[model samples]
Target chain A: MPPPPLPIAPPDTDPPGIDQQTLLAALRARVARLEGAGREGHGAAPIPVCEGLGLSGGGLARAALHEILAAEPGCGAAFAAMLLGRAGGTVLWIGAGAEALTAWPPGLARFGLLPANLILLRAAQWSDALWAMEEALRCPAVAGVLLAPDWAGDPAAQALDLTASRRLQLAAEAGGGIGLLLRPDMAEPPPSVAASRWRIAAQNAAGAGQGIGDPCWRLELLRQRGGRPGGPWTVTWRAAAGQIDRESEALEAESA
Target chain B: MTAPRRYLALHLPAFATDRLRRAEPDLPQDVPLAIWASQGPRRLLSAVDLRAWAAGLRPGQALADAQAIAPDLLLRPADPEGDLRLLEGLALWARRYTPLAALDAPDGLLLDITGCDHLWGGEAALLAEAQERLWRAGFAVRGAVAGAAATAGALARAHGDGPVAPSGAEAEWVGPLSIAPALRLDPALLEQLGGLGLMTVADLLRLPRPGLARRFGVDLLDRLDALAGRRHAPLRPVLSPPDLGAARDLVEPIITRTAIDALLDRLLDQLCAKLRAAGRGARQVVLMAWRVDGAVQEVAIGTGTPLRAPAHLRHLFRDRLERLEPGLGFERMALEARVTEPMSGGLQSALAIGGRRDEAAAQLLAQLLDRLRQRVKVRRLAPRDGHWPERSVAALPLLAPMPEMPVGWVRPDAPVLLLRRPQPIEVVALLPDDPPALLRWRNRPHPVLRAEGPRRLEPEWWRGPGVARDYHQVALASGARLWLFRAGPPEAARWMLHGHLP
Candidate 1:
């Protein structure tokens, strides 16, 4: 019997020429050099995703997709919620498939997003999710939208190739809304016309135990339309004051 | 002030047997036929047709006794349900003439012909038209028209044919009606009335009403007052089909698309204007076009949200309007806004109607919904009180606000997409209790790369017989993340694929 094609394209999944050990060492060395750049005079500036990588906000020339790929089950959702809480408007999460649901208020509040302000819509088809996103983004009232395609893979999800992403980009432009896409840790996103795309994976804090980690992630900015997207950066989200802070000491020590 | 109402009573005295005879048209009219049903021991006749009445066969007579008196009497068991159903169907058919039609149970209909009778040239012509139609439909209907509902019912029962009592002469008209038909009393009371030589309504009215109440029951006085038009009996229609709809008579039979579109626009503007004044918006709009050849073409459109704007509402009808065959030509068009919601502050404000962006987004949704040829609906997921992950949530075709999940709600990652039903799979597990390492689903082998905890969700046993499930998040080597559950306890378990995560 012949073997079926592999689901993940090799180049997309591992992002060629960088091992985990080498990537971590490089991120730590760079973090030591640009540590205080994050806590700027502007108190609540978005935490920089990576070297030369900023969050998609405030005069980006166009509305775009901020893709976050998680290393574990709940990590991507938490990371996506972090970006959503700072979007400054009502957030719509489409098709978050959880046992009960992913819109747990207290679970998301720790990541600094209000579940009350979030409205969840479910679509059996990925195409319907895209359609739902387009309708929601036509009005400026929606500051951002997070889409979790409910279907695994079928003709329904096949509707969401590059073409579907392009349509979302156009709709966000019209409504001036930002879109965030949450994919599984190893799942490959089809070629999308997203203005910006970043991959995020959960990283345990020095002492993560008993409960989930305190929202630390290794973020990779793979795509940025006009600006240059470099390598991975370690980002930490603080829940007490609802802010994102950069950690450089661990990165510096790892490099040494 | 509300306009004075005129009601027409359609009374079928032999409703059960009459409906049976009509259903079987070959039944000989010369035969004495009565419907009989067993009541405890003996078969008692429940309904008798006209021929049975002439042959001395009556209701409540035992079938054998009735057969002895009239040797060839036809006996069929009484069907009261069939009788009521036919009567209600006839009442609904009467909606074409007047929107207000109510079924007076066992066998009667009260039609409020107030302003509608004029459309058939007058009350007498309307009654005759309906009588002719009912006769053609195999019903022996006694129709009577009066200013009051009870008076019409009493008059129709008394006179076996058409009888139109004038508005002011209600008392005089029922004055001569026999007391047996006017007010049926107990045999004892009836004998007393006969002994007193009071055979007609006039005799009872002539006697002091307070004295009559003392002799008989107080109901006799209420019945008499209702018949004399002194007391009003409110007609309880099945559903008063409202006059909320708007219709138009075209100057010329419209044949072209432009003419039909123009008429629809005019009708919608007028209809929505009235709806707006009533502080309501329509959720469903029906456009019924009565063609010149007497065929009615209808187009119905439903919306996710209430709508009142004429252009937006008209746009919804464009696709359905194309499907409406003009046939010869349409003579009139009627627009009905059946389901409505109260729109606050009259018409929707142009900017930020409810002072929320969701309202604007919802409005924008209408435009996209109009262009899409799919059945647009808002699906909702609500957490049901249960322990099983499969039974923990329910789906409804509405967008109800999600309440906060319970404090301790937690489970391993489940799929956002659920198959219509859990698919049982062939599995080869590395261990007895762990999730299957290799499972064949839909004729394909998916080897497990990594797996998560066996999140145990016990069945809600209080509900019914159910097996507890051990759910797992399995990432197949093909990069598929599936929520698979093992049925029953770990000692004896079978695998079933349930959900798919993104």
Candidate 2:
């Protein structure tokens, strides 16, 4: 299904001297300036080319909180690895409970994340994991932080409320690194102050004959603060090339 | 030629009695006291106080005979271990006079005061000062200085309070001393020498050297030669003090955290200065707090890398400060670097260049890791050489260097989330050797969509015998991919879910 069209201001509502295009450009520049003021030295980290074309700034803003939810059970690790591969410097991976022991280095290496550049912290509880994530996000040496707290089974577990996530966002801004919070797909997801919310699920590879090929994910942009929220796009990670490309483009290229 | 070596020997004759008096200050000072030890069938007086000596009772006399000589003699059992421990303590205290101090065993201390006498005016003044201090501490001490350790020890034991022997006058000084007590010879030999009228060392020296050696054996000659500076005597000094340490004794015992933190800050500053001067860094440090009630509490911290930055170390110790129980207030606090490593000095600049920025970032990361480790377990994964999924990667220390992996070695198509222990699953396959078509895991049934594999992984032979496993990567109907494996033959095969792949 196609996405709904963006709501546009009618032509009649424009001022006497300004056109719609000019006004929109002016507003965009103003937002860019406002956002750039908090994030200096660290600019936007470009998403892969196929996905970048869909977002307004062609990338995700650095030094900001972004949430990635796994609609299916096992696709979160690959999605997080794909995003962390684009980050520079050291990456701290924080997790709790049985989820903590699941990050296999060799598998992450396939996604272009070297084991040497990664520090794995296994927190004993959810609170400790959150504290570690905030601490890692505030360290200038760390370029990225992946917090995968296991909040799946227990409904009584304290969710990451707005205040907690806001603190993490501010810490990321101070340290100039991107923070990724990966959680199991929830019905409401409580409340969060993250800049963008994304839901991803595993998708079967289209062209592989009777075998699993490169990992493919259907990524959906649920909410974005300053960019267009649109997705459910099928994307494939080419491990050999260390790049992510749109599944359709990949197929077209292969056929050609 | 180098000047001759000088040694100062201190003999505590009433050490056993003195130690008891110091421990129990209420003991009667004028009463005759003697410590006895069992020697085979009979108990003998091992040590006697000055009062006992004045009462005509001496060590080596049987307790029964000593009681007959002095009816009011105070008796106590001999503690050889305790006496040796006290001697060791004295040796440590003697280090303040000179860095080289050794326990002479039983009730004596040896100090190599070769070039150290000048620091305390002269040899006589140093000896007088050491004797006065021991006397004030309730010990009956006799001290002497000579060019040879054995000569000094013999003079102190036999001649009581003797003048320091001039450098090359050891033979003359030891010539008039009694041979039995001065040379510390065997009692049987002493009796034979007594029968021959060899009472003084001079009488034995006047005899022919070859005849004397044949009569007394080589040990006596070795003792005589050592006393005359003809042989070298080796002294085993105590363990060296800590490389870097700082301590502060409070006039008013402090119990508040602020006061303790202030004290800790000053101590850290002093310790860091010492560390800097020695070109070293502390890997592990312990903070010891001595309470007014005589109880000691300690807290220790370790760093992943060698560090001397006081602020970073203080930060690491911040949370651990709560572990110390400051009961009745702490009278003293000491910080010691228990483990140290060599670290090169680096320049600190306000403006970081390209390389300097990297250095700063690395240091920041190390500090972050240390802080995180205080609360949780932090590690880095390193690839290991193995075909088995679990053995292919190993957890390494946070700051350990990652070695270069072997070239041309391709990483296997492993799952991202490898379970620590595989979960059992019920599986149905169309053929006995094919991949699973349907599976039940965690009590949930799922139909396998795109099944792949029977990738056989042989058990490591050197790790003992184990069944071979045939793994299959199956895509479930719910969009979850699972790594499943079958162990043993088809008739008795067991299936398990090992990992979740993306």
Best by DockQ: 2
TM-score of every candidate relative to the true structure: 0.58, 0.66
- Write the residue-wise lDDT of candidate 2 on B1-502 in tens digits: 7778889999988889999888778888888989999999999998899899999987899999999999989899998888887777778667656657898777888899988899789999999988987887688899999988888998999888756998788889989999976888878999999999888987877888889899889898898888877787788887454567888778899998998999999999999999999988888887878666444677888887878899999999998999888877887788889788888884222211112257778788888887898887788877778767887777776676775555532354578777778878899888889889898866888888888898898988999998898989988777688888999876999998888788
- Give TM-score values for chain A, per-prediction: 0.68, 0.82
lDDT of 1 by residue, B1-502 (tens): 8777798988878778767776888988888888898999998888888888898988878888899889888889877777777777777566556778898776788998999988889998998987776776667778899988888888888876779888867899899999887675666887889999999998999998778899888988998998888888887776556436887777688899999899899999998898888888887788877665444566888765567888888877886788888877876788888788877764332222112445555455344444332332333344555676556565532323455655544332534445546778788998888667898966988787667758887767788887777887766655446668888666767888776543
The candidate that achieves the highest lDDT relative to the unseen native structure = 2
The CAPRI class of candidate 2 is acceptable
Q: Which stretches of candidate 2 lie over 4 Å from their true place?
A: A1-15, A28-38, A47-49, A98-100, A151-155, A206-208, A248-256, B1-243, B347-357, B407-412
lDDT, residue A242, model 1? 62
True contacts kept of 1: 0.03
Candidate 1's C-alpha runs over 4 A off are A1-76, A83-203, A208-213, A217-235, A240-256, B1-3, B12-38, B41-99, B129-140, B178-200, B240-243, B248-266, B276-307, B315-502
Residue A110 of model 2: what lDDT? 72
lDDT of 1: 0.68
Clashing pairs in 2: none
